[model samples]
Target: MAGPTAAPTRREPTPDEFVAMQQSPEFQELRSTFRGFTFPVMIVAFIWYVVYVLLATFLPETMARPFLGLNVGLWLGLAQFLTTFLITWIYVRWANANIEPRAAHIRQEMEG
Candidate 1:
């Protein structure tokens, strides 16, 4: 009969292990920075969109504006699209500059 293979040895973590493995301050800063930047923008955008919809639905005259032959509804929709793209761009830049590195560090700490 073949002998059983030895189990892999696992070293106990030292107190310094936690210090080495703690989340980076940059990670928290990035999180709070994004939260501060995005929360208000998201709230304002939501309010603006809701008000636009309400106005368009309740007051036709208010929404009756011409833009390159398109009416207000179409124009507002286009504006919303543009706004979405802009927000996406901002988020991507934030992620690349701050979030990605922080996330990588977190993942490394978890894995280690």
Candidate 2:
């Protein structure tokens, strides 16, 4: 009876090959779209969060002033919740538009 055949050798990719994969146009395009959406959104979200903190810290009198019978701080705090939902919605929409198609394209290219 013949023994089981030896398993084929599987070669790991080299560092240069990994770097080449990263620097490929398809990968670069994916990185560009992901970063473009994330960085801007993150910067804006951080700025918004900082502003909320500063207002709650240094601007007590103004934040305590009434708007629609609720203090401005309360309304602004509520606005933070709204902002979170809004940002999530925007990110999903942006990902669908700018990232998903490119990712799917790259996946198809890889698999095919």
Candidate 3:
């Protein structure tokens, strides 16, 4: 009926619409908090990696030993995985505490 109902035309989001979606106080604070958490983590991870390289290069004697049949490098490599898991855990906690409330507020704002 109605010539196949002519699919509804979708409008592109304007800058104002984009700003309204992302510029709410709750969303702005959420973005800032996440950036704050992530930037420090990135810096720490970079420093840790640099330190690891330095140890492997200049302190091979110290890192050359085996721990539990795995070489020091292997152990240190596993530590990186552990660190990633820890970061994920921290992010989950942060999301629950800091991100979720803001998200709920945004949803209410958008819906209401």
Best by TM-score: 2
> Model 1 misses residue 51 by how many Å?
2.2
Indicate the TM-score of model 2: 0.76
Sorted on lDDT, highest at the top, how do the candidates line up? Answer: 2, 3, 1
Q: Candidate 2 regions off by >4 Å?
A: 1-20
Instruction: Give the alpha carbon lDDT tens digit for every residue of 1-112 in model 3.
Output: 3455676655566677668989777678889998998899989988888888898899888798988998898799789889888988998998899888888776665655
Prediction 2 global C-alpha lDDT: 0.86
Model 1 scores a TM of 0.67
Residues 1-112 of candidate 2 have per-residue lDDT tens digits of 9999998665566677667777899889889889988898899988998999999899999999999989999999999899999999998998899889988776555544
Per-residue lDDT, model 3, residue 69, is 94
Native-referenced Cα lDDT, model 1: 0.77
28-56 in candidate 1: lDDT tens per residue? Answer: 67668779878998998898789878978
Flag the better candidate by lDDT, 1 or 2.
2
Clashing pairs in 3: none
